[model samples]
Target chain A: MSAERLLWYTAVMAGVTYLIRVLPLVLFRREIKSPFVKSFLYYIPYAVLGAMTIPAVFSATRSLVSACVGLAVAVIMAWHRKGLLPVAIAACAAVFVTEWLMRML
Target chain B: MNAAERRQAFKTGFFDGLPIGLGYISVSFTFGMMAVEKGMPAWAAILISFTNLTSAGQFAGLDVIAASGSMIEMALVQLVINLRYALMSLSWSQRLGPEFNLIKRMIIAYADTDEVFAVSSARAVGGKRLRFIYMVGLMIMPVIGWTGGTVIGALASAILPDAVRSALGLAIYGMFIAIIVPPARDHRSVAVVVLSAVAASCLFHFAPVLKRLSTGFVIIICGIGASALGAWLFPVPEPDCKPPDLEERSAHEC
Candidate 1:
C-alpha cells in the first residue's frame, strides 16, 4: 500500500473508533436512572468476557489439543480464585508443555 | 487530591496495567508482522498500531487495506468491529469520578481498549469510582507496549521464535477467563449471564446460518442479549444510586 493510502485508511479507522468511544463519554454527563439499563451495564463486562473467551480460546494455541489443555488449566486455576497473572501464566505454561509432549509423540 | 495521593493512584493504575501491557506486546507483535507480510511498509504498520490501538479492528482494517478496499468499507468494518467500545464507554462514563471532565474524557477515551475497559469496569463494579489521573496512568504502559511491539515486530518478524509466538495467543483469553470466573462463582446471576452469553456465542460460531455473521456482530449480539436477560431476571436494586456523585446517597433509601 502507498504511504498516502495507508495514512488515509488509518485516519478513517482511528476516527470511527474514537467516535464510538468518545461519543458516549461526552454525551452522557449524568447518571442513567433506568433500572434495567443499569443492570444491563453492570452485567455487560462479564457477558463480553464470556463471549470473547469461548470458542476463540479453543483456537488460541497451535493445536486444538494444546488449546483445550490450556483452557482446562486456566478454568481450574481461575475457579480456585487465583490472581490474573498466575492464571494467565499457568495457561501459557500448560499449552507449552502440551505442545512439547505432542511433538515428542 | 494532594500530590502524594495522586502519585499513589497513578502507581496503582500503572501496576494494574502492567500485565495487560505485556499481553498487548504479544498480540500487537503478530499484527505488525502480518501487516508487513501483506506488503505494507514497516513504518506504515507501526503507524497503524500507534494510532488505532485496537486489536481485531486493526487486523480487519489491515485486510481491507491489503485488498485495496474502499474508504467506506474501511470505516464500516472498523465501526462494526469496534462498536462494543461504545457500550463500554457508556458504562465507564457512569463510573467516572468528579475529577473527570470533558477534556479528560476525550483524552482517556483514546485508551479504552478491551482489556483496559475490562480492568477499569471491574474496578468500577467493585464500587470504586474511576479517577482521571489514574486512568492516564493505566493507559501509558499498554500504549508503549503496543507501539513498541509493533515497531519491533514489523522490523524483525523473522527473528521471533515460533514456539513463543504460538504460546502467546492464549494469553489474552486466559486473562479474560481470570476476570470473569471469580465473579461468576460469586453471583449466580452473573454466572447465568456469562454462561448464556458463552452459549450464544458458540451457537453463532458453529451453528448453521448464524455462523456466517462477522465476529463483531456475534459479540455484540451475545453480550447485549445475555445482559438483557440478566437485567430482566435480576434488576440491580437502587439503580439510581450514584456512587461518585452523592456520598450520603450510599446510606440514602433505595
Candidate 2:
C-alpha cells in the first residue's frame, strides 16, 4: 500500500479497536445483574483464547510435526502451571529441536 | 484514595504487568517480522503496533491491506476480532472504583487486552478502588514492549535466522495457552467453553464455505457461541447478598 493508504489503514484499525474496547466501559455504567450475563462474561476469556490458539498453533512453525510437538510441550507446561516465560521458552525450544531433527531427516 | 495509596497501587500494578510486557515482546516481534514480510515498512508496522496494540487485529488488518481489500472490509474485520474486548470492558466496568472518572475510563480502556484484563480483574485490591491507578501501571509496559518489539522485528527480520524466527512465532500461541490452560484446569465450565470453542474453530477451518470466512468472524462465532453455551450450561449461583454499590463493585466477584 502507498504511504497515505497505509496511514489510513492504521488509523481506521486503531479507531475501530479503540471504539470496541472503550464503548462498553463508557456505556455500561450500571452493574450487570443477570446471572446468565455474568456466566457468559466469565467464559469469554477462555473461549476466545482457546479459539485463537488451536489450528493456528499448527501453522506457527514451518513443519506441522514440529508445531505439534511444540504445542504439546506448551500444553503440558501450562497444565503444570508454569509461568508464561518458562512455557513460551520451552515450547520454542521444543520446536527448534524438532525442526532441526526434521531437517536432518 | 490518597495520592500516596494511588502511587503505591501504580507501582504494584507495574510489577504485576512486567512479565506480561516481556511476553508481548516475543509475540509482537513475530508480528513485526510478518508485517515486514507482507511489504509493510518497518516504521509503518511499528506505528500500527503503537496505535493498535492488538496482535490478531493488526495481523488480520495487514492481510486485508495486502489483498487490497476495501476499507469497510478492514473495519468489519477489526470489529469482529476485537469485539471480545467490549465484553471484557463491560466486565471491568464494575471493577473500576467510583473514583474512576470518564477520562480515566476512556484512557485505561485503550489498554484492556486479554492479559491485562485477567491480571487486573483477578487481583484482590483489599476492597479498595485503586483499580484505575493499577490499570495505568499495568498498561505502561505493554505499550512499550509491544511497540518496541515491532521496531526490532521489522529492523532485524533480515538478520534473524529463519529457524529462530519460526520458533519464536510459536511464542504468541504459547502465551495464549498459558493464559487459558490454568483457568480451564480449575473451572469445569471454562474447560467446556474452551473445548466448544476449539470444536467450532476446527469446523470453521475445515468446512468449505466456513473456511472462507474471515478470521475475525470465525472468532466471533466461536467465542460468542461457546460462551453462550457455557452460560446455558453453567450459570453462577445467585449472590446471597445484595449487589455491592459502585465503589464496592470492585470487590472480588470475578
Please give, for residues B1-254, the per-residue lDDT of candidate 1 as tens digits: 79987887787678667767777887899899899899999898898898889989999998999899999999999999999999999999889999888899999999988889887776564356887878988899889989988987899987767666667677777778887887787678889999999999999999999999888889899999999999999886683432332233222211
Give the distance in Å from residue B135's predicted Cα in candidate 2 to where it truly belongs: 2.5
| TM-score of chain A as modeled in candidate 1 | 0.95
Error of 2 at A93 (Å): 3.1
> TM-scores, in order shown?
0.92, 0.81
The DockQ of predicted model 1 stands at: 0.71
Q: What is the C-alpha DockQ of each candidate?
A: 0.71, 0.58
Once fitted onto the true fold, the runs of candidate 2 whose alpha carbons sit more than 4 angstroms away are: A1-5, A100-105, B1-23, B30-40, B63-73, B118-130, B240-254
Once superposed on the true structure, which residue ranges of model 1 sit more than 4 Å away at CA? B239-254
| C-alpha lDDT of all candidate models, in order | 0.84, 0.79
Among the numbered candidates, top lDDT falls to 1
Residue B43 miss distance in model 1 (angstroms): 0.8
- Docking tier of model 2: it is medium
